[model samples]
Target: MKRLWLIAAICTGAVLLAFAQTQQGSPTPQTFLLRYKGKPGDVSRYKSWFVMRMVGTMPTPAGLREGKMEYQSEATYLHKIISVAEDGTLEIETVKESGKARMGDGERMRDLPDRPYKRVVKMTNRGKVIESREFEDGEEEQESEEEVAEFPIASRRYQPTYWLDKLYETAVHNIAFPEQAIKVGDSWQEKVSEQMTPNCKVPITINSRFKELVKLDGKLCAVIQSEIDAPIDGQDNVGEWTVAVKGRFNALMTIYFDPELGDEVQAIDEARLVLEITLSGPNRPTLTITHRLISRGKTAKLD
Candidate 1:
């Protein structure tokens, strides 16, 4: 009888736990009201002011490291080809960048590349990055693996698809799937999620919506960054990302630009956005991005 009672108690506890989880599932979607004054650059032109602070566990070739850092970046870009004619090539260029990042203990790092760090992308019309070469300045050979792993590093010499993904995800509503195109959103809210790989399968979730146009720096600019929820990469992201540790997260972020920059103001196009993503799961770990900053500098303009 005692053994049977123990079994019953375990089952009851499991039921209650499930119920609690269900209750927490319906989280009130966090919202941010960002009102700023900026110029409304043309959608075709590119101009941006980006800032990011991220803290999470990062895996390096040597092992894992923990730290926090922030970066401020600016850029001007031009879209050389929007809809290419048959046999025509598309091009993007970066004009300028003046940015720095603060590592743990406020150690300043400098010398980052600008926008359009030189990459060749092949994608269907639906806006899915099929394949491309990630930028890597030759400096990797000079530094030891441990030295290279230090945080708050910056370089803008090369283009990375991950940054491109951020830019495309924010603006492009539809993406090309293997067979057909998948619509990210049609109306009010849009949910964009991606599973980053190599170290572990850490999924990133970005929830955004169309906010009103606000004036910034005496120019009309579009403001975005409704909500963002991400799990710590590495071990913490183990066991399918759940609602508990991963869900108790929110962000207040904004994307601003002068309409004069137009489509050039796209997130990744304007500058390399390296945000310090935070993760508070079973183990407490902090990580930072120590990589290229920005290289190209081209003013945003219509093709």
Candidate 2:
């Protein structure tokens, strides 16, 4: 009888050991189907900041001259969902709460007017822009020669208005997600084309991967990593000058998204670009410009 009891105890111990080994061998995978879940009257407040630095070298009659220019800007944006259709279309009103910029020799410009700038955007639930409109500021648009010549390459194309427009557009478009639910380690690709000017088109291809789902500021968030590649080659008329630009761009972006809210909580984008510019005139020397840009944005409850 003692031998029988000993045999029974050993059998129980062996079964327990086998169960533990099985548990350790198979780990559950982390996966989720991310979608936007929001309703009308939902409000989100966003703050964005960008810093850009450019170094250019141009050939001159005297010799080669090099110049450097830097620009920094910050803006607050308020987004309100006006209506949500059953089909998942959203009408959103975006207001520029405030903005300020600094350029040239590191002198901070005065703050923008107290009045809010406004824009209306229509988008789909999957982060596609259907339409967008910018309210007029009522001031006549004018460009001074001094402003045009400030930084020959960027001054003409990269203005405060352009930056602000791009910023709002990005916020409205958000991220391009996959059609089906994705799990960690899954990857996807998207193609984007934008008309930068009348004759210039910028084409970008992005590769994205789901990195992980982790807690951010006490909120569960999915982190996505993306790589952006764009090549630019176009000619466009800028005021009295016809400028030709050829460049290559590369960037990396990390986005923190709240799956429940269906919105981006935060994002960081860093890019490097190199361009060769040729103006439309005799004896015009080609200018080589290298630019670096960093942009960041965060969103929170309005109240």
Candidate 3:
């Protein structure tokens, strides 16, 4: 259970940190090539995707509950979101799957790779996302009441709405302290280590300063790992949380700056960010997120 929680923490933190790259004096309007992977030996039955559900204790008028209740569910991206910034900076939001819909017996969400979604994102000059809107393209809209009633569907969307610098600010809150890791309602402490990148050419070096921070993605993230932790369910007697696995695993992230892909001083491109992660605490596990950059635009428009 500790190892499982560690894996969940690392991967989910990585994704959130990567998405929260917007920080003070950092590059703006950037996009990255994202890939998330996870493989917890005995923690879960899910191997293909990361599941965010309810667990742990909860606070109530009566007392503390043994297990939390679940009210929402959504998974991180198996595929990545690629976007070119207007300033020539390539920005890749550590992508993930997130959408909730009500169904017959239970709620059904369109949060799979094959499922399609339309989103509109607006950003500022500093690469801060101002707003995000989702387009509801219902597939079962035409179904009959009986059929639809049998499978009632409602949808929830997770969108990014902040700049890299802004997210950086959020992450600082998750930085580990001696007392106990507490800020966003949880506390944790783990051994941290610093690891260098595979090659020396990469500007960013891998290190053990791993910590969690809140961001516009509706979760907390770690800098070295693209992991995420968020509230999934909250109601009467139960509660649940979701954790997205690592992106840019093995502390190896693709760096793409101007000159190679687009403008130089304005952007950074990370390919397969969080593709692999190392687990060595109580549990020995390693997960690799597989992602490929299909294509990139000349100038990304955020309006």
Best by TM-score: 2
In candidate 2, what are the lDDT values of residues 1-303, reduced to their tens digit? Answer: 001111111100000000112247687565565544466787777666666665667776797777666666666677777887787667777776776666663454333243446666666655556776666467545767556655446564643234323432432244456766677788988777667656777777778898888887776678877787777788866665666777766667676766654556666666566666676644654554433333333333322
Consecutive 10-residue window with the lowest summed lDDT within model 2: 9-18
Every model's TM-score: 0.38, 0.71, 0.23
lDDT of candidate 1 over 1-303, digit per residue (tens): 001111111000000000112236574422222211112231133344444444445677688776655454444333223233243222222222232222232357564543233223333332333443334234234434334233212211111224333433432322211222111121133345443322434344445543545675556555443344444333223232211111112333334433343321223222233334332333534433333223222222223
In angstroms, give how far residue 150 of model 3 lies from its true place: 25
Model 2 residue runs over 4 Å out of place are: 1-28, 107-115, 139-174, 197-199, 235-242, 260-263, 280-303
Single out the weakest 10-residue window by summed lDDT for candidate 3: 154-163
Best-to-worst ranking by TM-score: 2, 1, 3
Candidate that beats the other on lDDT, 1 or 2, i.e. the better one: 2
| Model 1, runs deviating above 4 Å | 1-79, 82-104, 107-116, 120-132, 139-199, 215-226, 232-303
Give the candidate number with the greatest lDDT.
Answer: 2
Candidate 1 lDDT trough over 10 residues, lowest sum: 10-19
Name the better of 1 and 3 by lDDT.
1
Backbone N/Cα/C clashes per model: 61, 0, 62
- Superposing all C-alpha atoms, what RMSD in Å does each candidate have to the true structure? 18.7, 16.0, 20.5
Q: Residue 296's C-alpha lDDT in candidate 1?
A: 20
Tell me the tens digit of each residue's lDDT in model 3 across 88-136: 2222222223433221212443332234443333332222333444343
